[model samples]
Target: MNTDRKPALRLENIVKTFPGVRALDDVSFEVFPGEVHALMGENGAGKSTLMKVLGGIHQPDEGRIFVEEAEAVMTTPLHAKARGVMFIHQELSLAEELSVAENVYLGELPRKSLGRVDWATLYANTDEILKRLKVGFTARTRVGDLSIANQQMVEIARALTVDAKVVIFDEPTASLTDAEKVVLFEVIAGLQAEGVGIVYISHRMEEIFKITDRISVLRDGEYRGTLVTSETNEDEITQMMIGRSLDLSRRTARGEVGKTALRVEGLSCGSLFQDISFDVRQGEVVGFYGLVGAGRTEIAETLFGLRTPSAGKIFLKDEELRIHSPIEAIRHGISLVPESRKEQGLVLGMNCRDNITLPQVSDLVAGPFVSDGAEVAIFDQYRDRLEIKTPSWRSAVGNLSGGNQQKIVIGKWLAMRPDVLIVDEPTRGIDVGSKSEIHNLLRDLAGRGYAVIVISSEMPEVLHVSDRIVAMYQGRVMRIFDAEEVTEDSLIQAISGIENGKVA
Candidate 1:
């Protein structure tokens, strides 16, 4: 794809600092036109900070930016927009309260010569862009009512509307499905045909090798290296990102598995999932594998007492549980690491120490006063355990990256020392290093005689981490397999609902 053309965007000697952290230091990279360049790195390795500097959200203390062959000073997002630089963030920027057309042309709405809003022109233009992407959505659709995939497509349409020269996609497929991802790839191909330079940031290795033409690795705010995609392997790129290769192999329990820690019989929660029965034993890990709407999350929520089961029985140590709230579940030594950490897990306005200790406030109480020293001591403990990278315990949870925030969520529940731990998509947005750490930690917890249940959409993750695999489809249990008996193909078939020659 290299055509001897100058890079569409270039950053030279870029340096940015945040208080005590040097987010980026002399990090330089180039993105050529018609090329898909992947930015690879672990969390807190300066990938997001570097992208922010390019998008004009953060000014570099020292560096130069070049658009094509000329220098450009991007002091604000609007200035970058004028230079044809667009960013599609993982967390979408669309206003959920507005219609699709309204969000598309929010600031630069079409106006008639009579100083009135041109409603017809706005919807027409939005429709044209949607059709161009081959996406099935109307301009009048409210963003709040749309799925995550549709919302992503609308974000892409906005970039194309601005005629973006250098477009950056940050973890774009974190919430997309296989079918939706295919459409996204097609759209990217269209952009490539138009000679648009793309900077893609994702933790998915398969996506990198499938779509990227070249790859660049960043670590600790410095440029590590760049490799041609065709000549590189996942191991090599992963090493460059983390300074070492990570191994997430099939693991066995260190000690003998114990008795049933938790059991569910005839668990039915309305139409979400029905007749679900499973058991988690001490020193064992159970993995629930399914697609987005396949009811895995609903199952986990019910176990955590966030959802009321209509007809079912939950037993802990063979004793029936009448749980009606999260407080009760935690009181019975059950805790859930929720799926959406930003929304369901942590309180963003609060500091890291407080969020980690929020669920265990009772543990830190001293009669009429909640102890600050207790919170700080607990914070120090988890900070060391999780390797959470922040200036201090006083730092707001809102300011940390997604990966770090997830660690705080995990730490919050771990502090409870629950007998049964249910983690829903525990490593959703975490980096490879953090993921490996969490994976090992889970295994350790089980080895220490705690029950662990992991629910994930990633096939390899489930296959590698779980002692047993529980496959589900359309809110029904398909089958369960021991770790050694499951293969990726069989798992995919089960997840896709193609069992016993019948597709459910």
Candidate 2:
């Protein structure tokens, strides 16, 4: 793979800083043509800052950027694009209200006779790119109407449209289903065949191993080391990224299962799910196992009052409840830590203090307004408990690392002191250490007499964390088994439509 080809992009001695934080310190790396260079780091490890500098969003205090063997300086995003550098951000950048074609060609639309856009050319070109990406939607489809997976494809198509040379993918597979991830890997393969230099940033170790040629680790704003993907193991990369090995063992049940904290009877949400029934005990973690489109998230959303159930009845302590909205659910002591943290969980513009106390605003309010002392006390308590590493509680949540941002979302719900907590994909794009921390936190929550529901696509996580597994397939409850009864292979088979009787 290494033909001594000139690196497509290289950085020499990069340095960047923010208020009170030396965000990047003398970082350096090179990504060659036809290579997938993974960028690995824990939260606050300067991964984002370095990428921003590469994308021309942040000007490095000191560094040399070379593009295609030529020294180059990216003064603006437009300049980077002109240099054939494309950055697909972790947070999507599509204009939701516009069509996929329009968003793809945004700010650089084709012109015809200086009067009108060349609509025919735009659609044709976009359609070709969509076909290449194996996207199931047309370019004429509105961006807002597309699912997160499809929206991501549109972003990829936009990067392709420019014929990019050096492409940066930031957590590109975070929201994708397994099937969708396969398609994305195919697209990446196609790009690689063209000798495109790729900077792939992902928290999923498996993805990094599967797709990357080499990995560059960053820790605390300093360059750690780079290793060939084939030569280094997960343990080595994880240690380099986090400065130590994390204890990833799943905690057992805190005590004997208490009374049933929540139960769902005949839960049906149209075609999303049907006749789903389950009971979660007070001191138990029930893991929902299913693939994409298997109605797991739908069931969680329905239970959290984000969606209306058609024929289901929910009981808390054997008492039926009519929860028509999220407010009602929260009022009834049920909370959901949603999958998409940035869009649904926390307001990025808000500070940790406000975000953590958002769910319990009513309780924190005295007379007419919120009591700052009360909010501060709650923030301080959970901040220490959760180990949210932030310079200040008032710093914007968006500025925090992905792990800390996720903690803020969890903190927001923990403040509610809910009897039932549902966490969906809690560690989606988090580092291994962060994932372990969040998993332990969930176990602790379940230990505290709260029924906890964990919905995850990760087989290892589900098998390790849950006392019971509810396997769903094609919108129906396939089977429910004790954690001891289902091995990883068996559970995966059950979730993939194999009968429980057939599974060992």
Candidate 3:
């Protein structure tokens, strides 16, 4: 808490560039020992780029890293490791089929003079590390059998094995439950007490304010500013992250929701969801709210035909529509911008133009060939409308920022011209500016009379964007509230099985 604490790690005038983008432009940051320093920015604001440079995943074009007031060389993960720097990423990299012991001792398993593996020592070491991190799962359990929260704990345990002095956590709680998050926070606090400097990267404002001692903001590969956590507020941090203040009140009230465009009656997928029914009226935005693993995604998948509803009926207007596959759903004027956009939504190797036309390209094709001109006109329209930041339509989507990639997904769905559109966590990893853009686009679509269904874990987002909000718990609709009538407390209460001052 002292202002005079010395920085354990310092990045001086760091510069990194990709093919068409300068990922980091003279960005500088410092982290003090025994303190939690949060790296704040929206997606593509260069937070991750700076972290990668420090972790030795990406070599900077120009910069100098200093550890303990001495210049350090971080050319590779090994080099970083040797300097007591370790990185734990959002996506875990543990082998599921392997036992915890095997994963912990991965390539450097203990051995005897006879050249035989020492399984006993490996398990013992794994157990010791897991205990030190306070992880509960057994060392013999398969990683695949563990929950996402526990898998993340295993990741932390792995880092502790090396006795790292500086640790970097990138979006560590993106998929963790509240209870799991508490455990992770406890471990981090413990590390801080041990004088281990931590760099925390996250999109959640609450987490940063709660955990960090100092905060740094990066925008478009440039260092914006750094502030003490006690001296800054969320709005200030958000403004710095996006280069402007965001008007969170831009979503206007749509006059009247019309007749139902899509209806789910007694929808049940047995273990996934049961007796779930909701009606999405034209010109209305409805949100499905729940905690992770609360069946929100399963319901969306069922509606999109990724999973067959064990028992239910889907009505598109007056006629019952049987959705057996995604193709059938598309034919019935339904399109879904799935969660995990990078993995399931867009083809990584393909260009933006190609992805936009993927859902409905037949209209742009001549007798037996695709019409490049037609595709260009269509892609250009949405790209411009969505304000996607990219070099060209020919640019590979994989090369774009996470926000741009999400815009591409939305553009792809728009190309389909669906009567009902489903977007899961539409702004999951986007920055404030991009989040506002995407939210406004969805509002515009609803204003144009498209039935929009948004599923999100962020409570404020649901309250901000929905015309009607449906709270789901244990795969069933717990309660429904008009957006205007819903407060954050009420919404959380419904989702958590509390209502009217008692358990529902």
Candidate 4:
């Protein structure tokens, strides 16, 4: 593990602060050559702030950064990259319209006489990197046409373009499938073999244990102790991050199932999905489980009137309806919590109160003027109900943590008092504690007679909260099993399009 070598990158006594918040406080961290160090923390634990300090995005109030035994002042992102520090962020920054090679060599494209781009050299260099990564796509392939997993490979290729001594990966596998994760692990291993240090940040414990050598924890901007990966366990790490051990057990309390609240018949959305039929009863949680691109999100969008179905029948309380828009869906007593909270769910520039009352702004008007009293009342109701941790109702939604931002989205939808609620990827980037809270919140909502449909890619989440599970594969329902009757192996097989070792 190169224990005798000097650290590839090191930060000492780092402190960063905003106007009203101290994001980082006296934090110290180091990554050795050829080692994978995991930065563990719950959302808003100062992990992002610390990374920003390292990336030169935000200058630390007090700190020192050293690269290979020499002090380095990273004044900008380009300076950080020049010092052999590269970051592959969670949300990729690649130019989607450009080719893989162009995206890889974005700023530093090879130039010929008179500043004309040297396309031949650029493609040749990018092809060598792609071949080394063993990816299937070519250098000339358009990045927008590639899958999410392959696009991530392009991000990694960009890192390799420089003489990177350290690479930071922030939740790289959040959108990848099980098979794709294996490929990512192989790539990380190859980097480790070449003596490149890696700083891995993710909330998934399984991946941390499988890929990391050391785990350093943070809580509320303070540095916790670091533990060797082999010597520490998930329980210990959970305690370090959140100050308490988590309950990793499944949901045991079941809500009483009543009459069907929502039913879909022969729902077809072109090539997205075909002949999909499912029903969610009152006071019950129905989980939809599938791999990425398995048409789960597409079905939810169809039901929410974001997309028009080619052919289908939607019934709410046994009455057929044709929903043409999101407003129509909301009027029909159906609400959707979209997958990407930043993109479709919340208005980042708006305050918490405004975001929560946005859908019902017209109703909130007293007489030709929106009532601030009504907006604050609704925001306060859901803020306490959802346990959203914000400084105030006037705080910008974008300043909150990922978990809190997600709760605001849910609270916004909950204000509508819909008969049926659809939540997609409820805990995609949330920490362990917040994930448990959100899971329990879904169950509590169901017990309160709100029909819930949870669409998740994580198998444990689907199994933990669902009363009945619908497994889909390649745009078709493979099977539906009662929570008590489903086995992990059987569920995996169903989602993989295999039943009893044969294609379903």
Best by lDDT: 4
Q: Where does model 4 exceed 4 Å of error?
A: 142-148
lDDT value for model 2: 0.88
- Measured against the true structure, the TM-scores of the candidates, in listed sequence, are 0.96, 0.96, 0.94, 0.96
Error of 2 at 105 (Å): 1.9
The residue-by-residue lDDT of candidate 3 on 1-504, one tens digit each, is 554777788999999998777889998898888989999887777888888899888998998999878888788877787788988887788999999888776666789889888988888889988877666787888999998778888877777777677999998887678877888898899889988899999888889999999999888788989999999898899888876787676233555678899998999997988998899999999999988767999988988899988998899996899899999999899999998887799999999999999878877788799999989998999999888888899999998878899999999988888999999999987767778888888888888899999999888788778898889887878888887677778888888888677986
User: Which wins on lDDT, candidate 1 or candidate 4?
Assistant: 4
Candidate 2: residue 179 Cα off by (Å): 1.8
lDDT of 1 at 109: 88
The TM-score-based order of candidates, best leading, equals 1, 4, 2, 3
Per-model CA lDDT versus the true structure: 0.89, 0.88, 0.86, 0.92
The parts of candidate 1 lying over 4 Å away from their true place are 252-255
Candidate 3, pairs of clashing residues: none
lDDT of 4 by residue, 52-123 (tens): 788878899999999888898888878888999988888878888999999999888999999999999999
Worst 10 residues of 3 by lDDT: 247-256
How well does candidate 4 match the true structure in TM-score terms?
0.96
- Residues 220-316, candidate 2, lDDT per residue (tens digit)? 9999999999999998999998778876554344466899999999999899999999999998999998988899999998988989999979999
